[model samples]
Target: MQSRPSPVPFPAASAFPKALSWVLVACLGAGLGIVALRPGQAIPAEDTPMEAVAVVPATVTALGALEPEGETLGIAVPSSAQGSRVEQLKVAQGDSVEAGQVLAVLDSYEVRRAAAVRAEQDLRVAEAQLAQVEAGAKNGAIIAQQAEIQRLNADQQARIASQEALVNRLVAEENNAAVELGRYSKLYDEGAISALERDSRQLTLEAAQQNRQQAAAELVRLQSTESPQLLAAQATLAQIAEVRPVDVALAQATVDRAQAGLQQALVDLNQTVVRSPRSGVVLDILAQAGERVDAGGNLLELGQLTQMAVRTEVYESDLQRVAVGQPVQVSSAALPQVLQGQVVRLGWKVQPQSIITTDPSATIDARVVEVQVALDEPSSAIAQRFTNLQVTVEIDTQ
Candidate 1:
């Protein structure tokens, strides 16, 4: 009876629980198998909404390419010959110039005027000196001196002739007295004359002897004095004739001094007119007309821009790769144009760190070397277009 009661209670338990569980399990396994066996398929936009995101492709390059090592240098306009205020400006900015061309001129009015004055003064002084030398003397003084010399000569000759005549007269008187005395002496000797007559004849002979001796002395004196005076007068005339040579030398010296002064004045005048020392284009004009300028003052700036050069700094790591004569490519951030250039030189030393970047991680304390690159083919047109333009230079490491 008990066993029958227990079977009756279990019968009311689950309603086909085992059979229903098996069916559900089979259905789930088949559904999972169909899902796994089907080919992979993308979910449709309509079925599952997807996010609309714009994706950009990433560039594959080295970190060095992203931030290449380069240098930025200041633009320099070449200098011209330092001068004073510009009196004349021949060319303007952006003008093509040749070698030895005159670009500007300083004030030359004063210089030219001074030069003219000096030239005129030189000529006038030279002419005056020449005329003075040619004139010989003022107020006919030389002519009067010649006349006086002639008169002195005539007087000396007349005196000499008078003295000679006196000597001849004295000699004649002495001869007559001598003959009378001789006759008286012979009468006395022959005993035909008295003692008184003999004494008187001896006295006359003694007196004639004395007179002859005096005349001879007078003649000697006249000859000596007259000849010397005549010779002296002739010597004086000869000296006068040679005086013109000395006068000519003095005049020539004066002319030379005048010429030297004129030359110095001309040099000073030329300094006032400042001319260009070389041929180049004017880059800057610091002075103008009517502006006072001192010597060596900066007046203008000139430069040769036909050929350009770039100065860049390379990192210490990449410095070994750079060398002289290596080819380089130059580009400008603003222009974005490429230029061909070659390395002309390399720095021997290194430079200090720069403070351009604030990132501590980006900054390096390592030294940098400078490199100079010259354009292979430079043109005036290109230079003018890109004058003072900032450029970036790149050197191949491989």
Candidate 2:
């Protein structure tokens, strides 16, 4: 039945249309294979064609780990109140120290010498005053007065003995004249003597009595006029006693003045010894031994390493985010470990613009604020880890 159908042939133009359809199908398969093997070709997720949308790429620049910039100032040694010379240095750079430790000493010779001289003068003056107070009077004056009193007493005794001898002689003469007068009277009564002899005997007895009365008056005068040497000596003794107490008081006052001077000198000498005011680590040494320094001169630099702090500079735009008691994270290029800190203070005024500048044209005239942060844990290990290290700090605004 099919051979019979072949007898009826088709038109050539119709065959051309069938060949064209096959060729078109093969070309479509080849185009699909080429598209599947192409690299970086993406297919849309959706079945429908999507409209084109315009997009802008964001401009991003990376900073150094994006940490806050910290600015620290280097300081030199501070001044000391004590004006002592550098006799000895107990610590050096990078050496640790304690509170109230002796740092150096000064020359104390001048002060000690002054004190000793004052003490010696005080002792000599005090001893001299004491001796003067103890001595009542001059020995020579006392001896002269005693000798005069003794001479006057001896003269009075000699006068009394001579008067007694004269009285005895006068009495014996009177008795002899009385006996002769009696014999003359008896002879006159017996008519063996004349009247003139009896009269002469009576006159002789009266003369003897007058002489005895004069001798007695002379003796009474001598007894009445007494020597004044004892009274003079008593007055001198009273005067000496009165002045002795005053002399003693004056001596005591001199001694007190000398003692006060000595004490002041000693105090000045003690001030020459220099010592540390507080405990800390030595940062630098400014002066050396035998160097003449002035008053309040710089000696050494010291700081408490156990208590560390971080200082950061915040830009004017970021100043609002910084405040007291805010948390911060600190990192240093020299140290691998990170540290935690808290903000302790915020600057009241903005800092000068020239401090944080790279180039003159790149510098912004806006002033930056300063912030101080206190570390949580400060130790020797932490100090060694961050010694002379440039640090970075990050603060949270929220």
Candidate 3:
């Protein structure tokens, strides 16, 4: 039996046995490869297809920021409302507003309103005065100088008459005193009256004479100076109408002054209520109701977001390849889709790159030219959602 086993070992050493061993080795490798690749599993990188046709030609890439086509319009509190506390705020951030729409109210409105009312009252008073003067001029041509003159003459005559009466009384008193003095002197010579009584009568006669002289002088003054003054006043009255041109002008001036004051008060009152200067969306709220702010201080920010553009900075070296009206592709990590646009403007000068990336490995310093790309309609719809957001722009310079 051992001899027969030796004879079978001869087949194991044959060429067919060697071929079978090679086949086994090949089958094992095939099985191992099959095991490595299950259904729905990814193929090895080496097995992936790398062949592709020429698609995108050449492009100039740049970094940029998104913005409205007209750029942001910065809005602040009205200069007239500076240094006032906000009493009422009608809108908040992100609220859309129209031109001249009230955004907030200042606490000084009550004061401004009071001033306006006073100015209006003053204006009315001036207007009424002017109207009264005009009416007088129309109704009465000129003041009656004759009537004024007659009144003055009458007053002068009355004064003159009173002086005459006083002179007559003093003359009669003087005559009486003289008679008494003579009687007293004669009695003294006869030694019938005392020396004291004779001296008293002499003093009484002197006093009566002095009084008559003063009364006569006063009557003369009234007839001369008083009559002339009355005549002069009558002459002046005759020269002017009921209301002179100068008077009218003064009244008109008062009206003008009142008008200016009223206008100023109205302006101040309008300023008390802050209004939006443009139609747009509110971007940020810098102040709230009941907050006090200084003149010209910022209270909020607004912008037009529906229509937007991309402000890009291209390499100076690539300036020649890029031009206005060139088509562009804009992309951003903040968004999911690639947006389209066209270059609307080219920078006239070259400057340092302003689009610095947050990545530490990014190149921050480079000479670049600023470019403005206007977004297309479909792209604008997407751009409106990301104002001031940084983006990558690719201009097809091919």
lDDT agreement with native, every candidate = 0.62, 0.64, 0.86
What TM-score would candidate 1 get against the native?
Answer: 0.53
Off by over 4 Å in 1: 1-86, 89-91, 94-159, 176-215, 225-270, 294-297, 333-336, 352-368, 378-381
Q: Please give the ranking of all candidate structures by lDDT, highest first, separated by commas.
A: 3, 2, 1
In candidate 3, what are the lDDT values of residues 122-216, reduced to their tens digit?
99999999987766633243446556777898988999999999999999999999999999999999999999999999999999999999999
In candidate 2, what are the lDDT values of residues 1-398, reduced to their tens digit? Answer: 45544576677776898989999999999999778875876566587877879963221110112121232222212243244456656667777767767655555546566776877787788877767776755677667666766776787778887888888888888898899889999999999988998989989988997897788778777667754764566566566545566777787788778777778766665555455666666666777776544655666766666667665666666676567887777765565577777778887887654333344685566566767767776423474425444456777555
> Model 3: residues >4 Å from true position, as ranges?
1-57, 137-241
> How many residue pairs of model 3 clash at the backbone?
1
Better of 2 and 3 by lDDT: 3
Best by TM-score: 3
Tell me the lDDT of model 3 at 384. Answer: 82
User: Which structure among the candidates has the greatest lDDT?
Assistant: 3
Against the true structure, what is each candidate's TM-score?
0.53, 0.51, 0.60
Tens-place lDDT digits, model 1, residues 216-273? 7877786677566666766666655554877888788878878777777766555545
- Residue 290 C-alpha lDDT in model 3: 87
Model 2: residues with Cα > 4 Å off, grouped in runs: 1-85, 94-100, 107-256, 294-296, 353-366, 378-381, 384-390
